[model samples]
Target: MIHLTLIIVDFLTGLLAAGAWALASAGGAIAALVGSGFVGFSLFRKWRRRQ
Candidate 1:
């Protein structure tokens, strides 16, 4: 019984870690996309001003 409990706990811990990792990865990708968009807009404004 103890062995089964330990296995269940280990599996739950692993699932939580994987979920956290996936969320972090998605957040990072979103941040990168937003940053790129901001930079692109800034560059476009500067180019427009010059013309």
Candidate 2:
């Protein structure tokens, strides 16, 4: 019975770890996208100003 409990706990820990990793990855991707968008917009504005 103890062994079964340990197994279940391990499985749940692993699942939670995986979920956290996925969330971090998604957050990072979104951050990168927003950063790039801001950079692009700034560059576009500078280019238009020169013209």
Candidate 3:
């Protein structure tokens, strides 16, 4: 009845929320990896020039 519907809606909302969080976490991880790669490349180039 109405209670069952409410429970279903709540469960769907929770699932959607979890999916959004996971997507955000993945995006953050990608950004961090790209940032690190850029830093490492710049440092290596600078060091190479000095040698």
Candidate 4:
């Protein structure tokens, strides 16, 4: 019984850790996308102004 409990606890902890890592990675990806979009828009505006 004790061994079973230990395995279950380990599995749950691993699952929680993986979920946290995935969330952090997704957040970073979204931030990068947003930053790139803003940069692209600014460049386009500057190009248009020169033209």
Which candidate number has the best TM-score? 2
Q: Model 4, 1-51: lDDT tens per residue?
A: 999999999999999999999999999999999999999999999999999
Per-residue error for 38 in candidate 1, Å, reads: 0.5
The TM-score that candidate 1 achieves is: 0.96
Put down candidate 3 lDDT per residue, 16-40, tens digits, no spaces: 9999999999999999999999999
- The superposed Cα distance between candidate 3 and the true structure at residue 6, in angstroms, equals 0.7
Question: What is the alpha-carbon lDDT of model 2 when measured against the actual structure?
Answer: 1.00
Clashes of 1: 0
lDDT of 2 by residue, 1-51 (tens): 999999999999999999999999999999999999999999999999999
Worst 10 residues of 1 by lDDT: 1-10
Candidate 1: where is the Cα deviation over 4 Å?
none
TM-score, model 3 to reference: 0.90
Q: What is the lDDT of residue 2 in candidate 4?
A: 100
Superior candidate under TM-score, 2 versus 4: 2
* Least well predicted 10-residue stretch by lDDT in candidate 3: 1-10
Candidate 4 at residue 3, lDDT?
100
Give one clash count per candidate, in the order shown. 0, 0, 0, 0
